[model samples]
Target: MFIKNKRVTLLSYWTSRYLLTLMIGLLIISFISALWIRHTTLENRLEMIEFMAEEMVNRITDVSIPGIPPDERVPNFAEDRFRIRDMNPSMYIINTDGEVISSNLPLEQREQSTFSELINEKEEIRKFTSAKNNKDYYAVKKKIEIDDELVGWVLMVESKDKLTMVKQEYGQLAILIVGLALLGWWAIYFLSRRLAHPIKQVAEAAKQVQSGNYEINLSDHIKEKEVYELVSSFKQMAGRLEQLEKTRTELLAGVTHELKTPVTSISGLLQAVNDGIVTGQEAEEFIRMALVETSKMKTMVGDLLAFNSFAVDAVPVKISQLDIDNFMKDFLAQWYAIQEQTDIVIKIHLLHKEVMISVDLIRLQQIMTNLLTNAEQAISGTGEITISLSEKEQYVSVIVKDSGSGIPPEEQELIFERFFRGENKKYGIRGLGLGLPLSKMMAQSIKGNLHLVESTEKGTSFEVLLRKEG
Candidate 1:
């Protein structure tokens, strides 16, 4: 066999066509979720910073130090008094007039324009980045009221840089997406291979059949129902092909032997008479034997021709209502005379006084004659043959039973097949095995059926069903 060029594999094709696209979609979703988390985290951190700054202001104004004078309160309050004051190391305190009150950050980091903007804003807390240093900051400004009169405002500032936190979240999400993609790759490969296995097996089996090898063993270890059915159908076809090959070989051998024997015998008989080896009464007897052989050959040829006609649907049947009881009486009389020397007793049992059925007269007689002949040949000695006629609702049945040795169990089904002669050679059976097949075809051409009703060591019975007259 010539090999073709290789193409893309099923696993890679499915992954590229579907799995990769799905992984990319999931990655996009993960990125968007990470961004949302970063935004929400930043907002929460800013709120926490503002709350801490307000607590510090309340402590400073109340002067929690025991004996600190008013002038020295701003500078003399111990830094150790406030625990939350150290939450933001870059903290700042400014008054309402935009003047710095106290601060941990240097003056260079503070922008006066930003402080002015914060004071004019209606909101209590606002966020902005310093223009000079590019550092992000959140500023919270609160008004200090003493005796129902507004005093100075307290402005608190904290630096807001969340690059490290955002980067950490993004890294975690990237790792998760990567892990899921790896798992998806394995899943896609397994499913794709599973789906493609049956097709591959079928292709391989076809190749073997093309190469004249019909012996194929296919596995039933498949889960998919459709694939299993396909495999089963292929196996059945292969089995049928194998049987056909065997049947053809048998047919060729049988044809060669059947034609050769009769022609050889006739040729020898004629040559002996021509050479004057026998004379008078002996020559006449030899001629008679030759004529009988010739007749047998002619009958075989006629059977073949009839079978060929029926195979192509050329056997025309003219159907009409037949008087079945009267027909069988005449038919059995003819067969009785034909088999008189064989000591076969033929009898008829008519259950109905009169039964009319729709059938082709000539074809019906031919089928019955063939069956009777087979029964006659099967009898090795004295035997009884019974032909029973019965009627059903819409059909009539003719059953032929014989007291001869019954057909073997294994050979019963094949008996009706063309060119199938069972092991009955001991009785000197001379036929091309077309009798039953031709009879069956003739029966079917007139819309009827022939079947073996039962067969045992004692006897064998065959039944024929035909449509009855309306």
Candidate 2:
């Protein structure tokens, strides 16, 4: 599609290569055909010359006149026959001494005729096809032989039917070819437009997709198979983009919901403290509550950022060999104080006593914290939160289970998105809804899946997969 050479385009759709090809091919073929037809004409003339030479020589030798005077004219038939110039316009003859006895056209000088000249110079014979005077002629010249002696030579010439027709045909062929080549240019222009038009439309559609307009309309005007298919593909792509945009919008609305609550609560409590509504220990208590809410707000914001983080400069994974059991145990100590507060039983179920694995310790702890926090929030007073691990042939799996009001099937699927929250909750803190999303993102970044195994009215369970150590 890109042209490196600029000299080519003489016509709108025409290129130098195409024009050169047509010209060269037509010229070569026409020239060769003309030569062949001309050759065939000369061959036929050769036959005619041979026949005429034989006839002329026979006429000269077989002529018999009884006592005809040398100075006087002979009988009518003999007189007319001896007059070689009167018999044929394209015929010529000569004596043994290369002198003309009789002629059709009178020559003022003694120079031999062209027909005679050719035979005289070549002695054997020569044939030629000439396209002089706008007529193609087949002419031949040869010496007359009798008793192994040369009396004279005769040249006979005639025009051929096929040669003349082919000669004329070359002109007509050239015109026809020129016309057809022009038509080819027209075809290229017309067809390329039909092709490029749809592609341009597709390009525009792609631009609109980038501009965040996902709903695209396609024209059915194109009847070509390939163009139609391209439009159809663009339409499908636009539809998918529309669905993704809808999902993104929903996510934004949800994040707004999460951020609004704590901010509102913090403002109200601070406003109460500043107005001198509560003083001394009461003011201190209100300030403490506001700080707690502010901390909670900060955590939610950090979780939101952590969950949706994507770009080139993200921290690379730092893997180290360590006992996952010991790692979890040391980390779980932070939450040990919480288990003592509630009547819920906490248990760790280990398939292997100690399984060594490689991962980022900080990120792994974050994933664990998120999962455990969600579990604790689900329980009201009396329940169990269990952490278990199992290794398959190729992968290791970790599970967290809680005895509490299970996640509703409808809400379970959406809970891992930013700012998503449970519909039914009697809680101290319904967070700005970023925990599960952060957990999911962390798990995915480590090439793992976090999934709900099962959820009932009494409990909910979650599974996490990770690659096993060799």
Candidate 3:
């Protein structure tokens, strides 16, 4: 069905290999058949012709025609007794003077002396001979006696039917083989498509699976055993597709819950402002809330984009040397108001010494902000949130812990997946699902990682690891 060109399709679809194999097979079979038939037919014809030539020679001597004397006449002849023209003689009878007296094939068989010369040879001669006139003969010349004295000779001339008929029959066989080969071309085309039908069905079924149908019913199409194997393999692949679809659905629900909260809050405050419910101080507070929502939206967008860039293996990293203690101090200064508002008891544990390492500043800030936001959400009413840093021989690690409702053991691993929120956490109050996944992605991008270290019903701690500067 490819529309590149009609002639191209005709050749490509059937393919020369099968056609060639079919052609060669048919050729060999047909050739043997035709050759045997032709060979047998011509051999039978030659045997019959040889018998007739022998009979004709015998008839000429035994049965003498009218106006012919038997005894004193030339006792020999050339050409068969069957006269060329019955009205005259068809054989050449030689006289005592070695001259022709009677001839049936007058122009050709008149060579009675030549027959006499052949018969006089030493060994008994009985073979076909060709004339100087390009005519051939299958004659048997023998000694004929009259009154016990040799007189003349006899020659039997037959046309070259042995070679002629064989050649003609061969032409007919050539035509038959050509016709059968043409038929073989059509046979190969249908056969090739029949063989490829199963492959095509598997491809079409896989396409339907890609269109999100996990339940692929391929019972009717896959009939042959070979085709069924491919179909079964596709069915197995469809199973994995089903699991991926379920994961995608769960991710969507989590993302929606995460987005709906901040959007709802922003809309409520904006609607209040529009209705002139509060002004002056209240208006300023609403404005600040709107800014906070805007900032939240911005963070969500950044997380999603940065995670995608990392997934594609293209996130840029600008590592620098900075004191980890000073970075945390600056980060706490920015979030001091949020901790105070939530009445969250905060504690920082780090050495003031310079903790130089390879890091991306903006990327680290994003990870810390997401972690702190998550920590703040976990603590509903005045609870302790601790930030602690430690350095290993070859890596730097930052740990954030919250004294709030920790993650369930079952949900601990899934929490880092994109758009996956915990079931027990309140959707309206908790951080968006993008935060942890984004933090994990950022950590891995700088040759680091993020993991939930330990969790219980009372608290959760998240660990971030980064390579120390070279």
Candidate 4:
């Protein structure tokens, strides 16, 4: 037979263990306290009996005749003569021969031999059991003297049942201990439940997320700092996941359409030429159009592969030190030579100081190319693209500012997210939206960063930071 293990929840786990430990600790303390109270009560009772015995002895000594035997001189004690309020013990006067001369004991307990046998002559206080009544009693004794000669003992005997105060105290103590234990258990039960509640909600939320449901609403009004932070962070993460899911869906449709357009165009153009629909020079034009569509398709495919490789750290970088001023001049000249926009002007503002920076030449070229292309595209009819360079402490910044309408405020934060395109550019742009994100990734790979300094209706500015070589 297989034995299944029982699972304990957070609430039960903490409360049950704490209650067990608390109960054990309370039991140990109560046990020790009960013993101390009982011992102290018994000692007080014995002391009271001893005090009464001494009083009776003094009374008998005062009434005795000189040289008279205690058996004849000592009188029987009256119940009221030595009694202090409600406390009364049986009083006895015994001779030196162990014979009870006189006693205030009742008729049934007045046997002289049995009473004498119960007293210990050497002890001032002792407990003894009577054979006739089979009852326990505490006996306290004081010696009687006449003319400085020992006569007998004045003994006080009280039944153990009369000391019921100890039992009453034990009852009160047990009640107090049990009351405190119950109070502690109640506090722990509620406190453990309060602590476990939020964690349970978070566990359920995690399950929902695993099932691909990103919309989750968790309360953030918790007073605990750590739990509040946990709930707030999970909410933000769910919001981001929801946005990414939407972007992925849009990207799938966009990529399919972008790739299919070129393929369809190429197929139609080549088919027309082969069927002799156009003659001579017209046929050559048709073939040229097909080649252009093929080139566009190749560029798109190359971008997708390159992005995947860089994401996985499969791309290698070859770093080399280059003088900033000279490299910028050569790089801008080559870039300008390829651009067909004659109306757009490119201006350079280089720093007077010579700054040497460690960078991979090809990666830096790619970063500069993407930034310049973006700036060029942002401009409308006739606008200027300013390239300024500056040096600070241990880094150099290359700023590209364009006198074009700035990006919408809402789209600025998401510019560096993969597969995310701005509302304005999604329809007008033909390529995949990987330019800025890929550029940022490459910048980070080379120990640098790229960020937008500011963007307004006047223009937009982007800054690229590179570490200065030692």
Query: Regarding TM-score, does 2 or 4 come out ahead?
Result: 4
Model with the higher TM-score, candidate 1 or 2: 1
Task: Quote each prediction's TM-score.
Answer: 0.61, 0.54, 0.45, 0.70
- lDDT order of candidates, top first: 4, 1, 3, 2
1 or 4, greater by lDDT = 4
Give candidate 2 regions above 4 Å deviation: 1-167, 203-215, 220-226, 241-250, 270-292, 304-309, 312-316, 319-470
Q: Candidate 1, residues 1-470: lDDT per residue as tens digits? A: 86688587766788777776877788788878887877776676566656656665665567745321133344322354332332443454556566666655556765567777787788887778788788876777776555545555667666665421566667888888888887878788888889778878888998998787999988888889998999998988887677767776886687778878899999999999999999999999989999999999999999999999999998778999978888888887776666646677888888657778899999998999998888877777899889888887788889999998899986786787788777774226778889999999898888889989998888889999888887
Model 1 spans with C-alpha error above 4 angstroms? 1-192, 220-240, 391-393
Count of backbone clashes, every candidate in sequence: 0, 2, 14, 0
Ranking of predictions according to TM-score = 4, 1, 2, 3
Per-residue CA lDDT of model 2 for 1-470, tens digit only, reads 88786543223434445556766776787678667766665465455445665665565545564221121221232344433321232455566555554444445532343544455564444444453445455555555555667666555454444323444555676677678778765666666666766777788889989998876677978899888988998897788567556756765665576578778988888999999988999989988998988887788777656655632326566666667778768877877855556777779977657777656677778788888878887898878999888886566788999998898886776676555566664135656567766676667776666788999988989888766555
Q: lDDT of each structure? A: 0.77, 0.66, 0.68, 0.82
Better of 1 and 2 by lDDT: 1
Query: What TM-score does candidate 1 get on C-alpha atoms?
Result: 0.61
Ten consecutive residues with minimal summed lDDT in candidate 2? Answer: 66-75
RMSD of each: 7.9, 9.2, 11.7, 6.3
Candidate 1 Cα lDDT to native: 0.77
Residue range 194-279, candidate 3, lDDT tens digits: 66666666677788887977777766465578767777888877875686578669768767766777788899889898889979
Candidate 3 positional error at 219, Å: 20
Q: Any runs in candidate 4 off by more than 4 Å, and if so which? A: 1-8, 20-174, 347-351, 387-395
